[model samples]
Target: MNIPDPQTFTDPEKLRKLMANAVRLGYEDLAFNCKLRIAEIAGAAQDDVIEREFWTALIAAEEFKAAAAGKTSRLAKIRTKHRRVGAQRLLADMMMEEAVSDGFETLVAHGRAELTCEAIVLRHEDQFSVDAVNAARKKLMDHGVAMTDIAA
Candidate 1:
């Protein structure tokens, strides 16, 4: 998929479509490229620009979730549940749910995933609270993963 210049792209719908297509195609570098674009867009003073970056960050988060989930039965389960609860809410809630229901290793993995999602959103939109990321970090620490390890 041809991703338009993030800075020059004026049509939000088209950008969204490109991002979605990139994700569906398993574009490995999409997240990195989107993150760079988002960082550049973050300095914009316009509300609309910030909102567009927010949606873009959400797409990156979804891509991360898909990559992390892989082709496991868990991924299939998540897909079914996502259709019912919606993607935005599901991404946030699923991590907590999985952390509670799964084993220690799974909990740590989910905590790291949650941290990544929170970090991505926070990086693009500072209006978001840091509490979620902090909680995720604390959960990981509780499970014996060092703070330095989490940071890395």
Candidate 2:
């Protein structure tokens, strides 16, 4: 199948309508028409209505999020908990980076002994990043330790 570009139009009203339709159809149907409408109304710039769509998408998105939020109490709780594990990993990663940059290593005692710094970023010994270093910086506080310098 072929997918069309989302920037073929230039009218706000049309884009809004298409977005409404896409929202009505649920976020899954972000089709060619929908993307075109968005790109067009966004003034042909990719981020034109970044704020508007953010709020609008949330309003349009709540139904899906809520539906996914549960089928039963226990299952829903598990899903939410699973989602939170990402946040925990993020926090632990931060602590690791902080320790490493401060010229020491950290022990992430999350029920096991894992050297946080050793897991990410290769030092002089040619080691692999243990996912403690992000694929790219997801947080503002961390830098790409390789080929990057702290702004002075």
Using TM-score as the measure, the top candidate is 1
**If scored against the real structure, what TM-score would every candidate get?**
0.32, 0.23
lDDT of 2 by residue, 1-152 (tens): 34334465466556556555655666545533453344234322334232232222222223233323432112243235436663234334443443332111111111101112222222211222345434223222332232232111
Q: List residue ranges in candidate 1 displaced over 4 A.
A: 1-72, 84-88, 95-98, 101-104, 107-128
Which parts of model 2 have CA positions greater than 4 angstroms off? 1-5, 31-152
Error of 2 at 127 (Å): 32
RMSD of 2: 15.1
Q: What's every prediction's RMSD, in angstroms? A: 9.0, 15.1
Clashes of each: 0, 4
Among all windows of ten consecutive residues in candidate 2, which has the lowest summed lDDT? 103-112
